[model samples]
Target: MRSLRRTASTLALLGLLAIAGCGSGSGSDASTAAGGAEGVPAVLNFSAPLVGGGEFSGAAMAGRPVAFWFWAPT
Candidate 1:
């Protein structure tokens, strides 16, 4: 009974340590960037010239949700 108890305690301790290690950052640039604060907003701005010899400026889709789709020429 004592041996079983000791084994259970050891297993619990190992599980906690494993969880802590998994939660720690992986010490990589990509990992650091991925750990940013939740619900934070990111903004990207750009201006491109139109094919009809005009400039398109301003937020193309401000205050709106946008989805992008890509098509292949296959």
Candidate 2:
């Protein structure tokens, strides 16, 4: 009976997660203000200071593909 209860609870949790995952797919006001979903920019132009020193420019790699990897010790 205890195992049956646990299985039922697990199934219930999975169903809840599945329902939550299916979002309304509607853009918020802030997203629309920032050029909406369809208005994605072709070129990313921004710069940020590196941790070790030096600035990274997104504009420099405008025509090329770029990939980023973020890691946290904790």
Candidate 3:
């Protein structure tokens, strides 16, 4: 009876350790999805004609902060 109790306790400990390991893997996956490994911004896609015109002239605000006002064509 005592040996059976000891075996049950050992199995319970092993099961807890396995659960902890699985939980840690999920946390790491969440961290990776939350913006790569860290210190990196997620890439975003933007459609264009980009708040300006078709001309690639030097008159465009390339390196400057520009406010974009979008309107639905409907």
Measured by lDDT, the strongest candidate is: 2
lDDT of 1 by residue, 3-74 (tens): 999999999999997997787664322221134333222331434566567866424544455643433346
Model 2, which residues run further than 4 Å from truth? 1-43, 70-74
lDDT of 2 at 53: 79
Error of 1 at 14 (Å): 0.3
Residue pair clashes in candidate 2 = none
Question: What's the CA error at residue 22 for candidate 1, in Å?
Answer: 0.7
Q: Any idea what lDDT model 2 has?
A: 0.60
Q: Tens digits of per-residue lDDT for model 2 on 1-74?
A: 99999999999999998997798864332221144234333334456777787988655654354666545447
TM-score to native of every candidate shown: 0.32, 0.35, 0.32
Rank the candidate models, highest lDDT first.
Answer: 2, 1, 3
TM-score of 1: 0.32
**Best by the TM-score measure:** 2
CA RMSD of each candidate after superposition: 16.7, 9.1, 19.4
Across residues 1-74, which tens digit of lDDT does each residue of candidate 3 receive?
Answer: 99999999999999997887776343222212263334222221133453456633222433343445657577
